[model samples]
Target: MAAGAGQAPVVTNGIHTAGQPVELSIGLPHNLGTRIHLHLTILATSIIVFLSSATLDGAQAGAAMSSFIYAIPDRYNPSQPLTTSLYTQPSSQDFSARLAKVLVRRTGKLCYVGGSMNLANAVGGGTVDEEMEAFRAIVAVVAAEVTKARNAEE
Candidate 1:
């Protein structure tokens, strides 16, 4: 079925403009530990692979994450299957700023958990009696960088 053609559920915290664009997505927090854990692990891996600096580049990552949410139609519900984005036009800088702030705010716990896991990996040796040690070392290093980056935000 078409997006706008369907009746949108009334959302109070953030209302969708009747004529505005929307994008349907499955927000990550709902994942079972397997998916979320693997996802954070992958994100940590990517950060290690691309990051050259010794600190957490929160502003850079936070800004990028925030910019991702601007959108198309109103058919999006956090509980459903991911949908294609409905783009009507570019969002304003103010909107983006608000979005970024919200993103950064929302990221508080995920960021903390990732950082914590990184630390655990770092101290657990390059090879664990139970798991891969190299990943932990990598995680520890990334955690330090992220900590440095996240601290900079304060």
Candidate 2:
């Protein structure tokens, strides 16, 4: 279901064996900069986020998939999750790695993060600063939603 007015939309899309919804699809409000779209799929056992940079008009994808990062929380040190690459490692590798790490630390769930992003220029994409801003915003939203869902379960 969706949150109240002025809140991000968190949609439940699947059910668990216990007859409770287990999957959530979250879409951050468009006002966030960078024209980026973050789709956080909260499965029963893990969290997968598909992120993409869109053109200014939001009609086309602005980047290509170059990296995939996964993280599982380190029980002894939540700040530093065990993160690793699962695919091509782009020069901007730290972006996804850090995102996944933070999400795992916050939600204590295995997180798989894959996305396409590029530096902003005449063609498309967003500036490094803009991208960073978008990522931070995305992490906050994902962590909050996942935590909220887990709390409900408890």
Candidate 3:
């Protein structure tokens, strides 16, 4: 769907499960690929916070906290979905801390920084500063949600 003039991008509430992973779908504004970059950065940061604060076993925590990031297709086109999956390390990976670190680094590269320039370009465009601010806002929201989820579990 076309966004109204001056309207902000659409960001869905994140879905968190007890034993399953979480997923977030963000709708990009036209010509705002930078927003996607910010979203990824926010997601990666939030995942790290979730991993650190959660009280579950390392492996279980990693598995439970894994996140999938999805962007709505450009112009609301359903034919081209943009998605990235962040998985935790298997049980053998030193209590899964190593896996968490690996995921943080990899996700930072793929989503936060410039790992997938082409992908980012295809999604939307905006200024780096704007993206950074957007990322910060999103991180706060995601962090709060993660905390709420953890409390619910306890």
Candidate 4:
């Protein structure tokens, strides 16, 4: 609700601060398809990509954001597959990462973004278990994408 309006101070644990807009991005040394593949069965595969940290709340969530994804193959094998990376979103919203789900649906692949989450809200009622679950859910989705790609390949 603060967009185009005054930047509100996000407060947590008696700490108050305001953040500015920043670009978020992530990189990968493998293609989105292959990453999805390795993640599917948790296969031992190697992919190198620089990932960015961004935030986005999905439609299911409430916040949303825009981001970029990229990939570069190992300067060694150009015939194998393209390296891939997905940048979530560039916003100070807590749900920007989730909004990335929408982007995944459209592109049907895993993306990466680099950004810091508002530790303020996270400091309260937020535990490592919760964050780990979020990561697990993301991995599951990536695995699903790999499965879909395999099905398509077949």
Q: Which number leads on lDDT? A: 2
Q: How well does candidate 4 score on lDDT at residue 77? A: 50
List residue ranges in candidate 3 displaced over 4 A: 1-15, 27-125
For TM-score, candidate 1 versus 2, the one ahead is 2
Off by over 4 Å in 2: 1-33, 58-62, 119-125
Ranking by TM-score: 2, 3, 4, 1
lDDT of 2 by residue, 1-154 (tens): 4455654555545543322334443443543333445556676668888766544455554466758988898888768899889986665578888888888877888999887654453132445655555676677667776766676678
**lDDT scores of the candidates, listed in order:** 0.24, 0.65, 0.34, 0.30
Model 4, 31-69: lDDT tens per residue?
111111111121122111122222222112322333434
Model 1 lowest lDDT segment of ten: 27-36
Question: TM-score for model 4?
Answer: 0.29
Per-residue lDDT of candidate 1, residues 110-140 (tens digit): 2211111211112232124312322332243
Clash count (model 2, backbone only) = 1
RMSD of 4: 17.7
Q: Candidates' TM-scores?
A: 0.21, 0.69, 0.32, 0.29
- Cα deviation at 129, candidate 4, in Å, is 3.0
Q: Evaluate residue 41 in candidate 2 and report its C-alpha lDDT on the 0 to 100 scale.
A: 67
lDDT at 52, model 2: 62
**Which number leads on TM-score?**
2
Using lDDT, rank the candidates from best to worst.
Answer: 2, 3, 4, 1
